[model samples]
Target chain A: MLLSIKNLHASINGKEILKGIDLEVNYGEVHAIMGPNGTGKSTLAAVIAGRDLFEVTEGEVKYKDKDLLKVPVEERAREGIFLGFQYPVEIPGVSITNFLRTALNELRKYRGLDPMSAVEFLKLMEEKKKLVEIQSNLTNRSVNEGFSGGEKKKNEIFQMAMLDPVLAILDETDSGLDIDALRIVAKGVNHLRRKDNAFLIITHYQRLLEYIIPDYVHVLFEGKIVKSGGKELAIELEEKGYDWLKNT
Target chain B: MKEIKTDTKEIISKERMIGLFEKNREGLFMTDSEFMSRIRKDAMERFRELGFPTTKLEEWKNTDLKASLEKGYGYYLHPVIDVDVQKVFHCNIPHLDTAIIAQLNGWYVSKDVPLMELGNGMILGSLAEAFKEYPRIIEKYYGKYADFTSSGLTALNTAFAQDGIFIYVPDNVSSQKTIQMVNVIHHPESIFLQSRNLIILGKNSRISLVHCDDSYNQQASFANIVTEVFIGENASLDHYKLQNMNNDSTLISSVYFNLEQAANLESHFISFNGGLLRNNTRILFNGKGGTANVRGLYLMDRKQHIDNHVFVDHANPECTSSELFKGILDENASGVFNGHVLVRRNAQKTNAYQGNKNILLTDTARVNSKPFLEIYADDVKCSHGSATGQLDSEAMFYLRQRGISEENARMLLMYAFANEVISKISIEPLRLRIEDMVKKRLRGELSVCEHCVLHCNTPERPLEFDIDVTKI
Candidate 1:
């Protein structure tokens, strides 16, 4: 198992968000959590990424059979847990290339490896830049400073391609992306997918599911996984809106 | 009515200054020119009337120099130190070739002659020597720009300062080598010194000047320095001021800039460390179509205090001025930025802008920033803004989530913040050196160097970082 969550309960400022959520994922699989607005899909990703804003009141999370809840945010990142932020922050003055190189070298150091040379780092950056079809000049600019909405999503995927996390949880990565950007992002994810890694993608609409097929789809509503099924279930839910699930 | 309490220290300091002038009138300040002597006397009268600035004044409200002034500081009226000039100051800037001039305490020190006449028709030497050699030029511009009547410190410096760096660039000549002036203070006890510099750029001339202030010891000291720069019509001047002092020192540096028609000026102030530093920078556009870009970056921590007061006078039409000053204050460090721009009634088509931004690391860290603009011309553009805040928390989380350590993440953010001003540096070598210094400062590793910054960082020991900052 890549990640295991047992009866997870979380809240923000004494307001419960993820109430009694249980989920499990294994390697070489893709799982999509489809939900309506205000559902707990993003909160689950935050808890897994070790964001401190959401307090975990009960239960536990296990990544690769280790107690992941005790790890720090950066430590979790080094342990191959990547969280694509819903709204990427604009860090002025920090070039995208610099940010990525620093992040990659840090992960290497955590694993008792030497830092990457400038030449090799540049080569790797060049190779990864093609995955998202980002222009070479875009990497020289500040990280998401003046990037369009589509560019931000592509940058996120570009980062994912560079880090190559064991388990990637994307929080609304397709939210603000246009159709072209959605296809590029999905293609980038598909290119990075391997037999050893898994993805837990959170989305509100089924429009993105057509590009990147998921093996399993979970219907999340009111802070709980109310229904879980195969890929066909996503099409069923998309046909009969989430309101049907609420009525049931 | 608000009652003003009399301060005994201010009175004593004022009286001490007056007594020093009376004692050194004939001996230390003996001048051959009667006009120079009269300028000194007039300055003394202004000092007696103005005295040292007090907190009661609006400009000095945020900065209190009473603590710095209370220290018993010894005054040196002459050149008392005789040390090896080359051994004392070593400028090791890689690939940066500059004409170096040194000053010990307040008097200019040189191993060669008192003045150097370059083949390019430029003169570099001591101000005292210039008073005798180029009396005509000195009499024309010596006291023309710096307004001693408004500032008591400037008045005191004008009366007491004996020897400082002086440069003269003649008409239509472009200086190939940058002129570097290094003012070093090395004393065992608390000391007080005054220094004055005068630079003249003739018509159609261009020159780059780098002025550095460094302290070799930790003893308490107070420095009152004044510099008058005159840029002739169609001339250009690129000026840099790098100040790095120990925490026990106090520096009050007032610089006056006079620009004629079509003259251009770019000035950068990179202050790394200081105890109590206040920079009084005033620029006057005396002719039409002049442009001035003044930028400053200061990084201070501990109990240090820094204040920057900039005044721009658009006296002629089609003049433009921009001021951008940024600082990062940590611990209990405090700062003040006062930018005042005045566009006269007839100064049409004038564009003036001023901005001050600060990031306070701790809640106790504070900054008082006031950007004011007074425009009398109806056909002018003027704007002013100031912002003070902490590092963005969202950006912090974003960087940390990418596997960067908390410490490196903070450094990256702060570097990005300080780089905005550092990027304005036109000199490549100086900009690179300042980038390294700023990085070391942000990491809390910048120690008081043995010499100035240009000589401090040798090529052998480059800064080590786990992450590559060169790309940033």
Candidate 2:
């Protein structure tokens, strides 16, 4: 198993967000957590990514059988845990090339590998840029500064491709993207999928699941997983709506 | 009369300053013209009446200089020490070819002579020597733009200042090499020094000037320096002021600029480290169609304090002026940015803008920013804004999530913040050098060195960023 959570409990500022959550994932699996707004979907992703804002009152999160909560945010990232932000930050004066090179070099250092040369880094950036279908000269610009909704998402996936994390958790990556951008983003994700890697895609809608099929779907309502099923459960929920899950 | 307070004692008092001026009237303040002596005498009397500013004054409210003023300092009556120019100061800026002008303590020094006359009809030398060599030019422009009556420090500098840098550019001529004026204070004991500089740009002339103030050792010192610049019709001047002093030093520098018809000016002030620094910058649009852009950036940490007071007077019509100053204060450091723009009644079509931004790294780090515009012209456009806050938390998390350490993330944001002002540097080599210094400064690795700001600590080495972001 790549990731395992046993009765994970977390809260922010004394307001309990995730009351009790249990989940398990192995390599070569895609897990989609579908829920309504304000249902602790993002909070769960943030806690697993080592955000210090939330306090895990009880339970435990283990990555590769080690305590995941004890690791720092950057250490989690170096351990191949990536979280694509919902709203990508606009960092002025930090070019995309420079931001990625620093990130890649740090990750390489963690794994006891030599830092990539400028020529090699630029070459990898070019390859990743094509996978996301980013046509503009966005790599030379500041990170997400003045980028459109579609461009920011594409840049996130571009970063995902560069890092190649083992367990990728994307928070609402398909919310603001258009159809063409949605297809490009889904294409990038599908191309980067491997047997040894896993993904935890959190979304408010199931429209994105149609493009990149998830092996298992969990309906989270009121901070607990109410229903768990295969891909067919997504279509049933798409037709029946989430109101049924509230009563069940 | 304003009541002045002081605790740190055993230093020169106002009465002693008056006695020193009277005693050295014949020897130190010597000049051929009687008018010059009268100017010096009047300035001394003004200093006696105004005295040093205390916390009671509105302008000195945030910065209290009582401790700095109380330090016991050796005030010299003349340049009694000789320093070998080549041995004391070394220029190590790689590939930056500039004509160097050195000033030791408060007096100018040279290898051959005190003055140098270039082939393009430009003159560079000591201000005291210029009093006898170019008497008419000195009489026409010296002490004309500086406001000695209002600022007591300016009055004191004007009264005791004897030797500094002097530059003159003839009409229709421009300098081929950028002139770098460096003032190095290397005294064994604590000292109080005052230096005065006068620069004149004739009609249709252009010049680029880099003025640096550096302290060699960690000795406590107080420097009261004043500079007056005059730009003739259709002339342009590029000015840069770089200051890096010891933690126990106090520097109070005031520069007054007068621009004539269709003149242009761009001045940048970059201060790295100091105990207490106050930069009084004043710009006057004396003629029509003159434009001035004054910008500043200061990086301070520990218990350091920096204050910048800028006043722009749009006295003529069809003039434009803009002020943008940014600072990053860390630990218990404090900073102040007060920008005032005045547009007169007849100054129609005048446009003025002022903006000040700061980022305080800690809860104890503080900044007071005030942007004021007093406009009497109904047809003019003026705006002012000031903002002070911490770094964006979202950006911090985003960088951390990308596998960057928190330390490197903070450095990237700070370097980005300070780069807004440094990117405007027109000279490529100077801009690159400043970029390296600013990076080193953000990492707390830079200190008061024995050479110029352009002098890299390790020469002949390619600049590299720690986070592998150098190409950008």
Candidate 3:
């Protein structure tokens, strides 16, 4: 198993968010987590990313035989766990190139490898930009600063392509993207996928899965996995809508 | 205590004028005896009358000068050690063709500037020389920009103003490189150094001037610097003041900029060091069609106390001014920022914006920001705001969640906050130097961050890649 979370429970501000959640994903597998608003899909991504706001009361999250709970968010990132934020933060005066370089260097340090040279880094960025169709101007500008909804999503995917994480967690990556941007983003993700890589795609809409094509689909309700099945379940959920799953 | 009082009395009695001659009696260019005597007597009267502004004064309330004055500082004259003038020249940017002036202590040391080579009508020399060469310009513009009645310190500076660079650009002449003025204070003891500078940009003339102060010693020293800039009609002036003195030094600098009709003026005041520093910047849009952009960033740590007071007076119609000042205080440091924008009557259609933001890194560190806008004109758009808070906890958590260490994340955020001002600097080399200095200061190192391995990583990607990255 690439990622295994057993009976996970988390809370924030004295209120429970993730209640006894169990999930597993193998290498090369793509898991789509579909849930209604306030069902703790974002909380799960935040917890997995090691965001400090959510306190993990009871959980066991193992990534490649190592306990993921003990790792910090950046460390989790450096260890090849990527979390595409639902709402990317705008960091003014910090260029996209500088931010990506810093993140890449940290990952290199974690892997005991030297950082790529500026020449190599630029070449890699250029290649990745083409893959995600991100404008060169956006990379030169401040991180997520003045970027439109679709552009920010594209930038996130570009960052994922640059970092090349082993387990990619897309948290509502499809939220602000149009159909064209969605196709482009899904294409970028599909290009980045390999036998050694796994993806846990979280979304509120089943439209995103139509392009990314997850292997398994899980319906998350009230902070727990209420149902798990094959990819056909996503179609069923999309047809029936989230109300059916909430009642089920 | 008795000895201390006696020493303080002795220091005050001499004043800036008496101290200048006493310190530089053997200098070669001390021939203007009558001028010296008059300036000395006038300075003495002003110094005694003003008697160092106290906290009781409304302007000096946020910055108390009691501790700085109690130490009793003497004017720095002559280099204590041999300084390579060539090395200093080489350190400056080469593309700038403007005249360069170097001052050691309160006396002019290097007057062999290439001012004549500067095409068109431009004068860059010592204030004493300017007084002798161009008396009419000095009489009309000097002391007219800054109000001495409200500030005793201003009066004292004008009275004791001995050696300072005076740059005058004639109409329509644009300077190629910024005029670089290096003020090196090597005072190893508790000494008070006061210097005055005057810059006048003629109508339609464009110029840039950089004032940098670097100290060699760590002993207690106090620097009182007054810079007055006059921008004429349709002229443009870019002024940069870089203050990175020793930790034991106290710098109280006041810069007054007077803008005329259709003038464009941008001033950057960067305060990155000093023990107890207070900077007051006053800008007056005296003529219609004037625009001013003033920005400042200060980094304070340890017990350093930095206070900034900026006042923008929209005195004429159709004038605009924007001010943004940010500070990052860590350890037990304290920072104060008071920004005031005043739109006078008859100054209709005036546009002014003032903002002050501060970030405190530690629990004991404190920052007080007050931004005020008083407008008498009805048809004007004016806004002022002040925000004082710690680093964003959510941002910190977000970065930390991404596997970056907490310390690195904080550094990144702090760097971003300070870069907002640094990135606005138009001068490339100076901007890079300031960025390096900020990074070093953040990492608790006095040296440049680029050379430190702990703060900066060694280039793994060859020199070519490094150059490309630098270009980007």
Instruction: Give candidate 1 misplaced runs (Cα > 4 Å).
Output: B1-12, B459-472
TM-score of chain B of 1: 0.93
What DockQ results for candidate 2? 0.74
> What TM-score would every model get versus the actual structure?
0.95, 0.95, 0.88
Superposition error at B378 for model 2 (Å) = 2.3
The two-chain DockQ for each candidate, comma-separated, is 0.83, 0.74, 0.48
How far is B152's C-alpha from truth in model 2 (Å)?
0.9
Q: Please, what is the whole-model Cα lDDT of each candidate in the order they appear?
A: 0.88, 0.87, 0.78
The deviation in Å at residue B253 for candidate 3 is 1.0
Q: Which stretches of candidate 2 lie over 4 Å from their true place?
A: B1-10, B30-32, B457-472
Candidate 2 per-residue lDDT, tens place, A43-149, comes to: 99999998899999999999999999999899899999999889899999898988999999999999999999999998898898899999658898999999999
Error of 1 at A248 (Å): 3.3
Docking class of 3: acceptable
TM-score of chain B of 3: 0.85
Give the per-residue lDDT of model 2 (tens digit) for B331-378: 999999989899999999999999999999999999999899999999
Q: Which of 1 and 3 is the better model by DockQ?
A: 1
Q: After superposition, how far is residue A28 of candidate 2 from its true place, in Å?
A: 1.3
Tens digit per residue, CA lDDT, model 1, B89-148:
556787777888888777787666778899988999899999999999999999899999
